[model samples]
Target: MNFCLPYSATRRVLAAALACAVTLPVAAAFAAQAPAPATLRLDYLHTGNASTEQYAIERVVIEPLPWPGNMARTVDDTDRGVNKVEVVDKASGKLLYSRGFSTVFNEWRSTAEAEKVNRGFEESVRFPKPDHAVTVRILKRDENNAFTLAWSTELDPDAPDVVRKQEPSALRPIPIRVSGPSPDKVDLLILGDGYTAGEMKKFEATARRMADQLFSVSPFRERAGDFNVWALAAPTPESGVSRPSTGVHHASRLGTRYDIFGSERYVLATDNRALRELAQNAPYEFIEIIVNNDTYGGGGIFGQFSTAAANSDWAKYLFIHEFGHHFAGLADEYYTSPAVYQPSGARVEPWEPNATALRDPANVKWKKFVAAGTALPTPWPKAEFEAYSRDIQQQRVALRKAQRPESEMSALFKRELAHEEELFSRAPNRHAVGAFEGANYEATGYYRPQLQCMMFDRSEQFCTVCQDAISTIIDLYSRPAPH
Candidate 1:
């Protein structure tokens, strides 16, 4: 049986270094004289649609925890995400920090509803509280896939109106793996929802099990010590989250539920404020919400959060696959599923690491990893795979229409995966790392790094290019300051 440590449980890993120390030699002196900077978070509303968009400032707050990221690595050079946030010094206009991220709003804009009605989503971005005032600029990609300023605001962390006090923390975080200070590691927080007070043990157990599963996978497996895993969840009144498709509705701790955007398997929390309020209590750079239901559903947003049904049969696969999106800005490589997004007629380059528009075959984004003689437009058994997938999808729709048991859905997925593995195993260039067509919810034009990957399917490992991409982010967070 799994159990959560009580609030009295002492933290197992203490901070080995301070947040302000940019290098090793200065760490001791800095630690002795300077206090770690507080965390400043900017809350705003993103309202828009497919063609037009607007942003509005909601508020600013100082979180309970100090900044969790490395001071030396303040700028994100990894060309990823649909949007980027840049914080600059107000006086000299020097860029202080920046990171790329995707939003629920961006995903919603791709769907059919965006053509008619406008929607709004609350968002927040955090940085180390600066000593002086700073200007925050949010950049969005234009039609040509270049970033342009969407919104900009001047922020004063010491302003009288900035929210500095928070409700007393009702829940404490459990340290699953604490390698070192949060500033020196990728601080990942696993939040549990739909877990009742009596099932707190289950949440803790699942969190620990998932952490082990994550570390057992490649890249993560090889660099386990570069991470610090923390678990936090508040007790819910029910044992499972809301599933409106089945006429079920139970309020969960983090407002997480299935059937996002009317897709049965899509799970995510729409309440960013609720999520951030609880997450701010813990030191976290990434979040993966573990829903306590036994449903086959999950969702992820780049640099924001990921979700997985913790008790699902395919929990391990869902855990790692969704994390790929949240952790490394990896695009989904599979295209067979009926996603909510509408198809695009024009080919625009995606900013994700794995998937590409392949508009210029000669100058592929991942050309460095491509081997000689490997075709730019790599061929695969597309017709057969799609045919098989269509049939399976039909059966899947039928099963769901009948309101079948979760076990039935799980079994069907197993058979589907088995079929795919069998087909790919016999194909030519099955293991090649060339661009394979059919990705990012499209059947053509877009490409993936390899024939098989966790992003592509329910495989247990990331592709070589994916491994490198993940390593780059890990380096951004975990690499120590210059000697």
Candidate 2:
């Protein structure tokens, strides 16, 4: 007290002590915070009909967030926006949770453009944690009103069974094969097309019937419990029962065109924006386009969109068969059918599972299925083959005569059901010659593997080759439900 320090020294000592105390607390706080959990990434690949749109997810992973008691799972749809996701507990076989989200972009014509849009969308998604076992689905939109599911998850990380990415060249290309709700639980979304509010109910019924037929088949029957069907309804004004047309025309490939629907040319070629917008709401494995018309026309390109001419007598069968092509990469077996191909390339090995020019028979995709006694270059019966060919020539002549612009003959052909029926009946052996009236290829040189199949004709039966292909696709999607 007698020798007290100066005021400046006293102030300096107090300041140093205060600084030390502050630093210690700050260090403790930093130590208490934990680092973010690692992320689990998932990618989606789609395989459907060729006539429909197709897409794939390139970059994105689903990571789990740490949460107790399986109450809720957090998902990070990395970089790509999360359109929709559904969570199902495999053990419980019950839907635990589901959510639908939206995005700014509507559609992209090219995959590159889609990826860019997805990248921007992905930046906006934030997750609370990164370590959880839950299934997530992602979709991207495109033209033809098509959307592709890019990813999914297996709910229990501890379970040995899980979904895997398929090789690009794998023979079967579809994501899921079962027809009913899955035991392991699944989330499905049915992409929509030109249908109105009234048509939506019919569309759903049609889809349900198609799904039921699909599971009733062999491989699907085996694995019926591990699947689900969800509809993502996308409707348009052009998606109704009928439309104005300039009468049906006969082409050597895709026989008879009814140019009445304004949607035909534009729907398949343009409409990507609408597709993407619809995809932003649900988790789906496949995107099915339900056209509003009831005409007997449908098209499917492998790993692409599957479409059915709506409201027809054969809608259910047509749906399943076309879906086989879109989902399973199955090849058309009837080669003599009318088609859109120009036939320019050298007679090389075809990419389809059923057709081949025998460019290299030794390594055919379906070589295993070829019967031992089956002859290579199977001989066509001369009498029946010639009769069918003659009928085609006559039909061509009739079609040309009726095609005169603005003539009564054209009008007569357009309204004459009897004439059309008579013409179709002439080619009773068309199936035998493998020359169907409405396929996409020339009649003589090409031959489809099966004599009677839905792909070959509107016949209800699917050939063994097609059935096998469907089975393989189902296996790829999930393990078949127990018998």
The top-ranked prediction according to lDDT is 1
Predicted structure 1: lDDT: 0.85
TM-score: which candidate is best?
A: 1
What TM-score quantifies how close candidate 2 is to the native fold? 0.50
Tell me the lDDT of model 2 at 261.
22
Give me the overall lDDT of model 2: 0.42
Q: Write the per-residue lDDT of candidate 1 for residues 1-483, one digit (tens) a residue.
A: 222222221222112232111222212222222345778999999998888889898989998666777888999999789999999999999999999999999999988889999999999999988889999999999889899999999888889999998767667677788776667788899999998999999899999999999999989988898988889898989898999999999986577888888899999998899999988767789999999888888999999999999999999999999999999999899999899998888878888888888888888888998988999899889899999999989999999999989899889989989999999999898988788999998999889989999998888889988999998889988854332
User: In model 2, which regions exceed 4 Å deviation?
Assistant: 1-188, 216-223, 235-269, 360-364, 382-386, 389-440, 444-447
State the displacement of the C-alpha of residue 183, model 2, in Å, after optimal TM-score superposition.
11
Give one digit per residue, the lDDT tens place, for model 2 in 1-483. 012222222323322332232222111211222332322333333333223333354334332211111112332222111144445555554554433333222222123334333322111121222234555445543322234564554544444443223222211112223233222223344554555556666667766766677667654555566565655454444444332343432211111123212223212312332343343233234455656555555655443356665555556665777676666655565444343433534544444455555544454445676656555444434345446645654664465446443343334433433443354456434233222222224444444554456665445666666667665555444535556
Cα-based lDDT at residue 197, candidate 1? 97
Q: List candidate 1 stretches off by more than 4 Å.
A: 1-34, 480-483
